[model samples]
Target: MEPVARAFAHVANMLFPRGCVGCDRPDAVLCPECHALFNGCLAQTLGTAEMGRWFACGWYRGAVRQAILSWKDHGDEECDRPFSEVLCSLAEQAGLPDHLGNVSREQVLIVPAPSSLASMRQRGRRHMMPLATGLASYLCARTGMHVRACEALENRGTAGRSVETGGTVQRSQRLKGRITTRGKILLKNKAVILVDDIVTSGTTMRRCVDVLSSQGAEVVTVLSLAHTPAGKPTKAGRHFSSEI
Candidate 1:
């Protein structure tokens, strides 16, 4: 931000006195205590062939859940920078540098998981674009490769609540024919890393992977800010399959 913008922001904060998204502590978007929850994040090897591997900053629960909801749905756009920082931190921890050691920047594409056109319009922005771009810059600096953030996948106008907000089976069925790659050769034979704000039933991520694969992109893994917890079996030991 420029000096003028910074000054304006400081004045605004003083007037509004924002609280932490998680704990509502004054003047913090996310406090250290809540932010600490994302450290040492675990990778969940979901049962999706296309997803290969999936990783997240933390499990979506408690403060994390509230924080994500606030940013994703309520137009808390200020959280974008902090969230992008967390994602870059996750990438650093996951040794993405080593993974791209051999591939030129041109051969690597950081792909944002597509949001519906409706959702983008509702939010007034492509929410994941900045985060993906930040991650691409990090990969470029670390690996000395010129990486690009490719908005390759798109969601067709499927009329219904998303899987994250509706029944899993029905949402999965609705998502099946809705995602596809842009008709371009940019992704052909390039290594791609998928980025999303959250992963619930894995439906969205898998659909993205499938479309990218169809476009001949080599999707290596997925990086997300959070994933819904895989809780205990509902009944008769039928676990909630993350790989819908």
Candidate 2:
């Protein structure tokens, strides 16, 4: 049934192409105007020494937020390519690839932050995986580095509650011991860059960093599609904002 629906959607798109996800402009996935919204290259940092820096392509507001929500929550898979490009561009602009060495036996991995089992079941896919793979490919081409996407993280379901709808401290506590490496991750002494669609409170990203660091992986930084501006966390911010 899902496959049939997807096939129908593909056929319909071919016959009557949809408009930009960000602006509803005709004949484009993401029009230049809306794409511009994702070009800000915003950098955020977590105060925790163990938690590495974080970067986002845009503020989680206005058209950028809309586009992200459409892609992430609503299954507008068409935006994946554009979002991947944005993240890769942000990486390049941040001087990430320049700092990387040439291809080595140990790959510099792009690791996607794990979605909760519930979220995965609801979305029917690990949405961040594509972005991670795409970014890895881009880095391989740009830096001649042995980079690849590693689904190294998995969420080990919370107890009788959701991680959402909590204060920053509360969320951090809840996420503790919730994320674990997927398998025998060979991350010892390897470099990693964590990827996610959105980050707020920095709790999720920090927890991810903690798990990777525990495995002797040097996480260079965290990257996301967009983040909320600094201030009180609005409902929107809590929904999809990166943390510093």
Best by lDDT: 2
Clashes of each: 1, 6
* Cα lDDT tens digits for candidate 1, 113-193: 888888877766788888888888888888777788889888885534353567667667878888888666467778899
Error of 2 at 45 (Å): 2.2
lDDT by candidate, in order shown: 0.74, 0.77
Name the lDDT value of residue 73 in candidate 1. 74
Clashing pairs in 2: 45-244, 46-244, 199-241, 199-242, 227-242, 228-241
lDDT of 2 by residue, 83-123 (tens): 99999988886667867753243678899988888877777
Residue 48 in model 2: lDDT: 40
